[model samples]
Target: MPVLQTVTRETFWTIGPVGEAAFYYLAAVAILVFLYGVYARISEYAAAPADPFDRLDDLPGRVARATRLLLSNEAQFDRDTYAGVMHTFLVWGFLTLLIGTTILAIDMDIWTKLLGQPSFFVGRFYLSYSLVMDALGLLFVVGVGMALWRRYGVRESRLWGKHTDLEDDAFVWTLFALGVGGYVVEALRILGTGFPDFETVSFVGYALALLGQEAGISPATAETVYAAVWWSHSLLALGFVALLPYAKPVHMLTSMANIVTRDEQAGKRLPGVPADLPPDEIGTGSVDDFTWRERLDQDACTTCGRCSSVCPANEVGRNLDPRDVILDLKAYREERAAGEAEEVPIVADGGESVIDAESMHACLSCMACMDACPVDIEHVKQFTGMNRRLTESGEMDPHVQDAMMNVFQQGNVFGDPARKRPEWTDELEFEVPDAREEDVDLLWYVGDYPSYDERNERVAQSLARIFEAAGVSYGILYEDEQHDGNDVRRVGEEGLYEMLVEDNAAAFADAQFDEIVCTDPHSYNTFTHEYPEMAEEFDYPVSHYTEVVERLVREGQLPLSPALGQTVTYHDPCHLGRMNDVYEAPRDLVRSTGATLAEMPRNRADSFCCGGGGGGVWTEVEEERKPSEERLREAVEDTDGAVEQFVVACPMCTTMFEDGRKTGGYEEDLEIVDLTELLVEAMEAAAIDGADDTGRTGAAAD
Candidate 1:
């Protein structure tokens, strides 16, 4: 008989003043405890050796971008669509319910008590809010169900593979009960209120109320049951909030902070070592060596194992599980934060270490872990610091040591003399110009591997032929060239890397070139990003050779006749594609030669590593399968052997994949060819009259 306006619910329907007072008392304690937990976590972060919050160049823009990213759930969807949708529902649903509750509190306490206003939680506004809350609340329930199914039913591998405790499950179950319990309480309250017409707008609760009425529950009993359930639900939700900073649920807060504070240059341009820093402080060896941001990284980890799942080292059964590195550091951080004796090392050769030496050494530094991390944990940043410590302690792999020594003594990793750097060019019919002696449009920085490695030397000469065919003015540093030290820096020899940088920067300063180009993505990456940071005056423009070639072809500077006529698959180098966002140029070059590009399952930014980054080309690690071998199999098997040629842009990838092809028994199925070699083959076929087999003709032939 009542109108909808008169069908509103009270804030404290069944509870009297005493119960209300008691509820408020518990609420105060919960709020205080939550604040204390937050403070304690902040204090721990503030105590880290360095302040990692210096990225304030665009404070407002950073916050806005991070907020947009978090809400978008783009990172969550990067590799796992199922997990992405699951997390999206959970996060949005939780926020909706939270907002609904906060509105209720404002209506009851703030607006009604402080502002002396009539309650807004009634009639039209209330009905709309109830309907919205009920619908979104179902999202929370569905998300919890999906999580349970993924974790227990389907058993997602990414969620496993690490040591987990009750807290992990407890965090999910708490959300489950909180969401489910709220529905039950809502239904009982509606039934106890006699199922008023206005309350039907809360459709989920209304339907459940009908079920309760069908069960023949009396209004008196419904009221009593609702009271008990309401208290339990409220207490559980409050307790979850209070315990957030101390349990697995802490990722909720820390993940947001980490995303907001993440370095855009993270793995691309690593933090440099100071010139005068003491040897003991060279790298991260203890909890005290961590930065505040890195400590936040420890807390931000969800233990989802996404990092480990994507890691080339971990995938092939290397000891380097990226997820374990973070968790181990987190455990040690807590122990130290608890005022325990700091006797245990963060990383060591023995059991006293939280992180093992094998795991640290096994890292390829591909940044796949960082890319896959939804929370932006910067795994490479943390791992590189530890690597520096290992280098400082003389704990490098024997191969790594030899490579470092070679770079130090010979200005290259192959232990070859400087005069031999230009030996690869002697095979070319045309003489390659020396950059030091004359100005050129392009300074071809033929990196160490391409300069000296026999397998890659032919590829370098092919690029030189391509340059001659296009009539582009390009020159090499010749004997003046030194190693770029990209991989050396990744391997953590700060002093050696500095020496290499200094030597190369001097050559670069002396050379007269409009732009620097490299066939080595590793060299291109460091020259474009790290070199300028270390060398004050080394700010020359740099381009990958693929980018240069692709542009030349596009602009008709280099004519192509599409003479390849072969089905090929292209591999994206980590430094080029993922780290530097140069994904399409090399593929464009592959297509320029009239090759049919059959896409690999993992292409572009998702391309699998060739196991040659971070000095992986130098260091040897035993594994069930090498990452290079695994990738070769993917190109051959995933493409069903349709790919006759495996085209790569990087000299490092060329070296790694050539070995992989031979050893993995893919020699018959695939041929590992550099993009330049493939391009040169097409260019030679396109050459007109007076053109020799070397593709030089007309004015170039003269």
Candidate 2:
């Protein structure tokens, strides 16, 4: 093959002095408007309160990570492959075009104009640039086509949300015009040049030029067409730039900033209210109450309903839609910016509330929204803040208020006497040692549900049997243990949550143990993540029961017989799998029980909530269907009749699924068994009953 000759194109071939001057003047105005928009946005964000958790450490590392996520579209791809491909094409394609334009500007304005240097818009470089620009521009147009098709042709519901505006159309159409128009202008330019051999490197343009020639377009006419098309394309692009900050495409900048500054532990670990905060200002009452990062989150939202689509509350037809929550906040922010500064409530009852009380109460706080958000918006955190104000103002749910009162009066949500906390251990062959009185290797923090709820009490008993069979030295805080405050905190009762935390911390401080292990994922989450924030000396390592059980099974500490031979599906408790990232261990444990682990449609990180979190267990919301019922149906139907047993590690999941199993009439089809129950069955099949070394029936030998 012959070596291709160098090719170059004229930047202003058809434009006269007057046209060039007009172009420059318009370009300057567009640039100034763009800069002003950017500055105004930055100033608006800066004016908001600082995010307590938004630490600026490791900025370079953060930028690098954010760049990787943006370039790879990993998070977006994880949700939808079509969207991922379209977004990647659009981003990289548009970026390449922008870069090519910037290079042209540098060559013309900087190298030649300022330094009087020879223009480098020639030789192999220009040829390569032309080829790359043509190829990527085609991709850019394809991305625009895909976007339009997805939004309009396929009519993807996730793309259109409550806050979706005409601006969305404007953004997409402008992009479509610019991308297609650029190629049209290039084709016109090539056609005017008589389809030169070197211009073939701009293959799309060359092909279009050849087509135009075949259609009987003369060179003079092509030149005339080029001038008008070039001017239109340029102006369209400039107008897009000028309108950037005011349109849906503003996410282009805000998203990058949001992602770069995102808290990795956002939903998993929430920021607590400052002690000095006034009673009236406990939560986000108005626009001014939100942190700068949260305000940035509002702007960063691309109006994609990924968060709402994945939300269990929304999925179950509850009033809470995470996308609406963010967009509502954004609308309020804009309204506030436009001079509505009367300290209006963000969430209120029967008033001109930006977010309604029902929507606030409807949130499950399962972090499903946060998990689905590609822009890394902390939907859980934002809602939790709003909940604080609700709780402070006594506008919270009646059941939640009762639960809070129960927690305050009885140290548990069940309102059971403290003496009854250890009653679950009565039927067990072994006695769970009191951690306050005994020194043990593992301090088992038996959470409220396991200690009080009869069904979950059986699960706690099963765990006790497993501990006995494994010969693990574990003790419980029993009556001394208060509630973990995980759900309380999530429900927006920060003061009550702190009170519980302090009470639990005091119990922990008195307990003598090497490490703390929790039966409930909710308890484990707060113990491992939130507890240390309040209790500085709270240094004991914490683990969910699954982690400890998995280790024991791995170490051959538990007697194993895969004789169950049943097909089972594991329900990922949101706090365990999504919040804590302890997915594999429970699945491994299920497999270890000689059961075939059939996964549901959504599992692990994408696991559906059981409608038991964010005080969903405490508050009653009449919905078309419960999230737990939906989850059970998913397990029963989605697994193609393979799942006979629905195994879960969380007591909350057990409570919810059991209730759902009855309510959904799925009791005949599925059994909601806990991980500990399965483990006990597996060990019992191996002939290892709860027998101790001293032959005292594994009870506390007094």
On the 0 to 100 scale, the lDDT of residue 327 in model 1 is 91
For model 1, the run of ten residues with the poorest summed lDDT: 688-697
Give per-residue CA lDDT, model 1, range 316-412, as digits (tens). 8888889888998888777777887575766766577788878878888788888889999988888889889988888888898998998899999
Q: lDDT scores for all predictions?
A: 0.86, 0.88
**Candidate 1 structure lDDT:** 0.86
Colliding residue pairs in candidate 2: none
> What's the number of clashes in each of the models?
0, 0
Looking at model 1, residue 652 earns an lDDT score of 90
Query: Residue 334 in model 2: shift from native, Å?
Result: 0.8
Q: Any idea what lDDT model 2 has?
A: 0.88
Model 2 C-alpha lDDT per residue in residues 1-702, reported as the tens digit of each score: 124334577899899889988998999999999999999998987888999885578999999999999899998897699889988899889999999999999999899999999888887888889999999988889999999999999899878876788888988899999998988898898889888788889999888888999999989999988888999999999999998987787999999999999998897778988889899988989778889899989999988889889998888888888888898888877877787655577888778888899998888889988888899988888999999999889898999889989999999999989999999999987677878888999999998999999999998898898888799999998889899999999988888888888888888888788889899999998988888988898888999999998999999898877878899999899999999899999988888878998889898899999999999888766656888999999998899557889999999889888888888889899898998999888887767433433456445566
Q: What range of 10 consecutive residues in model 2 has the weakest lDDT sum?
A: 689-698
Off by over 4 Å in 2: 1-6, 340-343, 688-702
